[model samples]
Target: MPREVKKRGRRQEHKERKAKTTDHHQRSTKRLKTDHTADNGNALEVSGDAGDDFIGFDIAQPEGAHELQEETQFHGLLEPQEQEYYANVNNKIVANDFESAEDRATFIEAVHRETEGKELKVASSQSCSRYLEKIIMLSTPEQLRRLFSKFLGNLSYLVQHRFGSHCCEMLFLQAAKHVEKEHNKNASTNDDLASMENLFLQAAEELEPNMGFLLTERFASHIVRVLFLILSGESLDDDIVKAMLASKKKEKLDAPASKESELPENRRAVPKSFRTSLDRLIRSGVSTLDTTYLRALATHPTGNPVLQLLIQLELSASGKIKLSDENSVFHKLLPDPELEEDSESAKFIAGLIYDPTGSHLVETLVKQMPGKQFKKLYKNVLKSRLRSMSKNDTASYVAIRILERLGKDDLAEAKELIVPGLPILVSRRRTGLIKVLIERCAIRGVDLQDVADVIRSEYTKDDIDFLSALLDFKRNGVQDKTQKKGSESEKSAKSAHKTDVHGSLLAQAILQTSDICNLVQDSLLAVDVSTLTAMCQDSASSRVVQTALSPTEFNIQFRRHFVPRFYDQIATLAQDLTGSYVSDALWSATDGLHFMKQRLARDLANNESQLRDSPFGRNVWKNWAMDIYSRRPGEWQALAKGQERDQPQGGPQQNAPTGEKQKSAIELARERHAQKKSHSTNRKRNPATGANAAISTNA
Candidate 1:
């Protein structure tokens, strides 16, 4: 080797910080810079008391001052054969082409047997760690508890390890649901295994000593956030925490996530012990780190997110009971409850509004802080800056969060400030703010005509282009090929190609409001048949078409005009994945138009082969019940009208053909009620004839 360069050790780095502090005292105006590169092992170490002097300003640190040695725990390595075997198992799970659920269960059980004593070993291996994650994701409660017991004493060390951190995070998330499940049933496994809730408590206790250190540790901070969510029984699917977790770039596994991972909840049922532990854990981090260190973490790359989550937990805990707690982290960040202007806390809040990392923390505070503090902060710091903030790249999101909590009067003021900049927002692709303003206006009974006018003015092209612009649809001539592609342009192109999820959402919100719903309905109705078909085929814009056809959003006249445009393309729509959804929407759209319904059925029948051959096509055919229409058109029409008989004149006692489904209870009740009403009407019509009829019958 030409030369071997060794990395600096922890002691050497600390000494360098002490030296910098002395030099900074000699020169007060010189600024130091901090490294923001993506490394998870570094602890947040501030250079001098210089940051403490400037209360609300950004405190930069030198490059080497914040480095913490990444400690790798040496779990025993695997043999060649073991590595190959585990890799194969990983591929099998990733493929997930099982015949049935039972088969997958059997395969998992076999995997458990092979990796029984080597859980930690597999977890620490870079190549094998993902296999462990898949195993935990698919593990039963009993198996999860077994792994939890195996990693009992080693958690603090494992959390700092690069690969082991992922395993620990997965284990905690997957095991959290079991605690609630056992608590709800008031039972545990009928074996020697400890209760999952108790196991969770013990795991927290194991990491208690290292709480403060882990909060700033690169890999450990992520695990700490997950642990806090588990203790609080907060949903892991929250958008705030989801954004924080995605800060680190890692390859997402293709394995199926659990139900708890998919379904979101406001909160889950954690144990009383978990609550106590949560309180202690929160206190441990606050008490261990002094005010200076905690404040420094406000802008620290890895620490900022964890700090945001902690502050939210503190504010939201026990119905905001902890809001005034003296030792609370939120209290430490802003000691003044009033947040007076020119105060250090106020300056801090102002600085965070525009920072890339600190703004996220500001958002969490805006959402969870007490109402009095929010009112004071908004009046003193944010009220005059609404227009400027909404136009900023990073601060615009913070502005959106503030809008979510504003009162009707405040929202109207915000609307006035933001409406003037609609053109600027559109130019910067900050349509999210526009969408939120529209929603709040509708909710607060503010005038929506202003927003409608802005939209109409900006997209002054024809109706097709208006709808296309709202949906962010790109046409061939919209942009010249010679235009330089920046980062923003690339992002827009990618989003547009994938159907622009946010654009679709904006269109749906606009259609929900009656004041401006016609803007979209009129545009959709005015499009040519080919463009209409293209919108129906798209994954995102197709939803807008369905909403427009819905009776809640549009009247029958609109649907009558909209439904015919698809009649010629019914076969094409039925065969497409996205277009199939539009085809289903047509079924409900033609609710009372019997002629349109008949025409639709005739078109579907003509394309029966094409519909039956494709997968999405098959789903459309089944949903429309085309088989019944082909065999018995009369019964199909009767059933469509909520009747069970083949003919409308048949009594309730008359059943359909054999092997047909039975009538629902509501249908039977309706028929019985109609029969009674008809009998009484006949008797009322001819009383003398009814008496003569009865006398003849008795004779």
Candidate 2:
């Protein structure tokens, strides 16, 4: 009984101990759980709390023990808030929820709140552009174009103000290309293109003034190209095409009325206001527009209709803008105030007329100005313009028309104008203008002498042929006028005197003209011998002749006179007889002697003429004639043989008989064979060699 009681007591005591330990452990667990929740909630609010103390007893940490514990607990607790914040922030930033300025501002404000001062970054322009691209991809073609137009509209202002005029121009160009591409893809999308066109037109209206500088000289051509594309229905709107056509038709219809009304002072004044406005615009920096653009406006059918109007206005204004007085009010208003011979604006104006498309403009200019003023202005502009042109390209078709117009009304002024401008044509070798000028001068009954004088003064000697022709026409005019004034009997005498005067003037002119030798040759070949011989004897001809013909003309004159007579005699002799060598030889000998006498007389005459002109006439004449005589063995031998046979020892040789004797019987026979051998040798040489030898030998 005692042993059982002891064992039971031990068991009871063990149970009691176990129950106490369990109760204490349960209390500690309850306290730790409550403490851990409180600590976690407050840890984030505490500075450097670490939250490690709140970690469960079962947890273990590595190197960043406190940090890892704090992060894990903090993240676990704040995961919902973080996710909610990020979601709201991303939605506000990326979503197109903002349609208006207010919405966009509000959304941006929210992003800033979410980011809490940590750099609030927004999408870049490129990003926005890419977003737009994606929208474009998903959108219909029309929708895409509309969006593009809207984007362009918004960007253009920014592009112009923020970037520059060039940027704005580029943007518009890009927009145009984009619209063009879309239009190309779907022809039916022209409506969309038309809408864009309207937008561009509106934009152009507002931006054109500011962007004027962007239209460089080359831009004119680009604009024209664009207009052409539009006009041809290649890439432009129908409205623009219709407008251009209507404008052109209106211009054509108005042209005749304008021309007719141009005669009246009040009617002519109508274009002044328009001209003033255009001049103002051009002077206000629009002149910087690329030459290409100007050319396009002038040439391209679809180019800006307004540009055409402006061109007309400019041309009209050019007519009104005159240099009348030293302090001319209207002239002062002109863009180029300096009346320089070579003004830039003048060149530009000339170029405007030079273009084939500017033909109408030139006609309009002529019509608008007073007849006299028009001639003067046209000449000035043309002269200035031609001077600016390339040597090879100076003779524009427009110049010809201007000259024709001038010739019709004011031939004298036209001649004066052509004098300066003629060199330009000459440099270009434009024979067409030359012929046209000559005809016009003739038709207008302009004094050929005056025209010739002007041409001679202005152009080089190489153009003397042209000048001489003009002079000939003038001389003929004088003769015609004189003949008209006199009776038939007196007409010849009067005409002869007039001819003499004209010939004298022409000779003087020819002598004074450059390259007199060449001029004489060309003139002699082209003009009548009567005219040439008269010119040769004229006092004015002395300048060129004296310089060119000191010794050579003496020989040349003799040759000139002798050769023709010799050929005439040879023809006569050849015609008279056929077979009979002895008779032919005797006849040839007689003819040869006659030729020698005639040549000697000519030489003597030429020497005499030279002597009369010079102080040492007699001696010079003797020396020259003797030199020529010595060169002819046939004549010299004949003279020696005839002298020996006629005078047994001594007798004075008479001039005529001596000349005949020089080429007498025997020497003439030898000369014929020698001449034949020389002819054979000449025939054996190449034609080119012979020609070269001839020129060289003559020189």
Candidate 3:
């Protein structure tokens, strides 16, 4: 059995590291001139000798790690009075208690006046830096320009400062939008101000020489990550990328908005120069560090994320020059196009497979490497290890990444390896690999029945048992039973919670495949009302229920049986945080069931006060359109019936009358109206040709 890697929150570990090293300053390294790219071409397949006996570099330190020496810069501390005033300002910003927009602007302006010329001091001060973040968070484009100009030359030093890094991160994030705006020549553009693009490019240049060093530095790594993202026109909203930039525990400053602005989902348009700068940044990383130090970065806690992003940006570059260039980061990491199993590069790949930090780099490599490299690696390495890799906690994520890139035939082979392990994977709550496999099968149009059959066999075709097993319902009960005392019990509870989440996610993923979702749908329909209601009230399982009722997933028959399970419990569900979402899903699920829609709506109406009292319930009420149902029920019913009606099949002829079918009163009235309008138009157009308007109208 592979040792389970203990996964804890890296954020707290990072904080402890910062506390230890914040006083230290890193010394610049003499750049190595050794070429890492090898031009060796050999037989494409791995040798049989490349098994467990081979030793790669030391897992602890691949190279001699450099220690950062403390370098002090004098930024005078804030006076007691100044500290108090800024603290007050921070409090106000946090509370956001301004009477009006103008008042808030005036207050911010006053604070800005006092903090002018002391930006560095304020940003570096632990007590006052949060205020600096808040200011940047709410700064106008012009104000941002002024602050950017002030911080331009000091970015090299400021980026590594513990408190100062937070300020810099926030500034870059806020200023990034302005750069996008300027690129599009929006209203935020100002001719008199320094261009955000130029300011950003200038900042990049200031840090360009240190870019390689920063990639491995604890604090500076995050700033460089954000800078590259902005320069490359990547969205900052990505969760993985965002997590790297800031801790979840970091205080959030909610800036008041005059109007909500949608961040671009796709890459924003960037200036031609920005792309050039991005290329230069990539080149700095590729050329600055030798292969050993770069490989060492694969496991460096602070550096691995930056390396992943660097790898991503390098491969994603449009010129495709890097893919062919032997000197590129891509080539340096894996010098052999065809990885021989016993080669150093192959060993390095193998070493990273189960190491927690290093495996992430493997994931990035699998995701972004060109098809040739991917196929070569897959053939040489990953193809043989899919089963064991999928079962290991650390390696399973890497497995997921590989599964995502496989073709249809490749996926079928992978299914062979992974499907047999589903029983073990479900037991371990390693459902991510399972989820990706099923999703890939769906996408690749491979038959899902193999995996579905495995599931059915494992859970023995009993719907509730299948669901309860997949949903990990027993774990929660076990957790409740176990949570009586010690640290061991707490650990059990946490583990159980993780199992619940993974199980719920797997269940939801299954529900998306209509053919294979039968087990889940049947289970949901057959489960008692109390059990169904309880599932909806819980957070993780609620998502499974919502996905089952999604418009595209299950049909009306499934929904008709499933939705009314909540008929007597609509009020109970609407009042819950998690259940409220299920209640909202009920509206979509009731499509084509007019009477059911009204009945559910009426239940919601009866509980109006209960819903109004709870925030979650109010959303359900609004989403259900209970107000319209109450005030104008006739119109509501018509709208509801129309919504529920099936789209006409074939054409108008299907709904058209057969022989002797009489039109309804409303239809006959509509015909008369059409005839009168036609007569009036004809009489008006041909009045001079002896057409009689009055006679035609009467007829």
The backbone clash count of each candidate, in order, is 2, 17, 2
Worst 10 residues of 1 by lDDT: 646-655
The model with the greatest lDDT is 1
lDDT for 343 in candidate 3 is 83
Candidate 3 local lDDT, 198-286, one digit each (tens) = 89989988777656666766677789888988888777788876776665776776756445233566777778898899878777655
Best by TM-score: 1
Q: What are the lDDT figures for the candidates, one per model?
A: 0.77, 0.39, 0.75
TM-scores for the candidates: 0.77, 0.24, 0.76
Judged by whole-model lDDT over C-alpha atoms, candidate 2 comes out at 0.39
Error of 2 at 82 (Å): 44
Of models 1 and 3, which has the larger lDDT?
1
**Per-residue lDDT of 25 in model 2:** 60
Model 2 TM-score on a 0 to 1 scale:
0.24
Q: If the candidates were sorted by their lDDT against the true structure, best first, what order would they fall in?
A: 1, 3, 2
For residues 1-699, could you state the per-residue lDDT of candidate 1 as single tens digits? 587875679998888889998787666544433363234443343434423322221223222223233353476999999999989998888888889877887888889889998988898899999888998888888888888999898887788888999999888888886787799888887568878988889988877755766777767888998899899888877775787764747667667654654434567888888989988777766675556678788888878988888888777775356667778788788887778788888888889889998998999889997888889989988888889999999899999998998999999898888888888876565679888888888888888898888887777545446777777766542232113234457545534454566777778888888789888888887777876776777778889988887666347777778788888688788888888888887776776776786788789899989888989888777667678788878877875554554322321222245676655557766887999999888775544468788897787
Error of 3 at 23 (Å): 18
